[model samples]
Target: MDLRDERELEVTRRKLHVLEARYEASRREPDENAHVHELSLRSLKRMINQLKEEIARFELQTLRK
Candidate 1:
């Protein structure tokens, strides 16, 4: 891959990493905030799924090139 491809891959990797971290954090819980945690967890899960879809699309594009 060229430098531009490498950079794009790196950026996508970092975005995936951030989504993963957010998902992990959402899984954690503290006292007196069960509802909040549940909402946060669900939202993060949705974001994680979206990011996964984006990564898949990018990979497909790279393969086609």
Candidate 2:
């Protein structure tokens, strides 16, 4: 991969890591507002899924190149 592609991959990975950490922490915490907490977790999960899909697409494109 070129420098730019490598940098983009690294940045995406870092974001994934941060989001995963946040998801785990949120899961472990006890929030008074259960509905809001559930919504927040769901949002984080959707973002994580999107990021994972982005990473997978990037890897597949790189492999095909």
Model 2 regions lying over 4 Å from their true place: 1-4
lDDT of 1 by residue, 1-65 (tens): 22246567778678779878877865764637888878888887887777677667777877889
- Residue-by-residue lDDT tens digits, candidate 2, 1-65: 22238678889889989999999999999999999999999999999988888888888888989
For this target, which candidate reaches the highest TM-score against the unseen true structure? 2
Question: By TM-score, how accurate is candidate 1?
Answer: 0.70
Candidate 2 at 6: error in angstroms?
Answer: 1.9
Candidate 1 — what's its lDDT? 0.72
lDDT of 2: 0.88
> Model 2 misses residue 37 by how many Å?
0.1
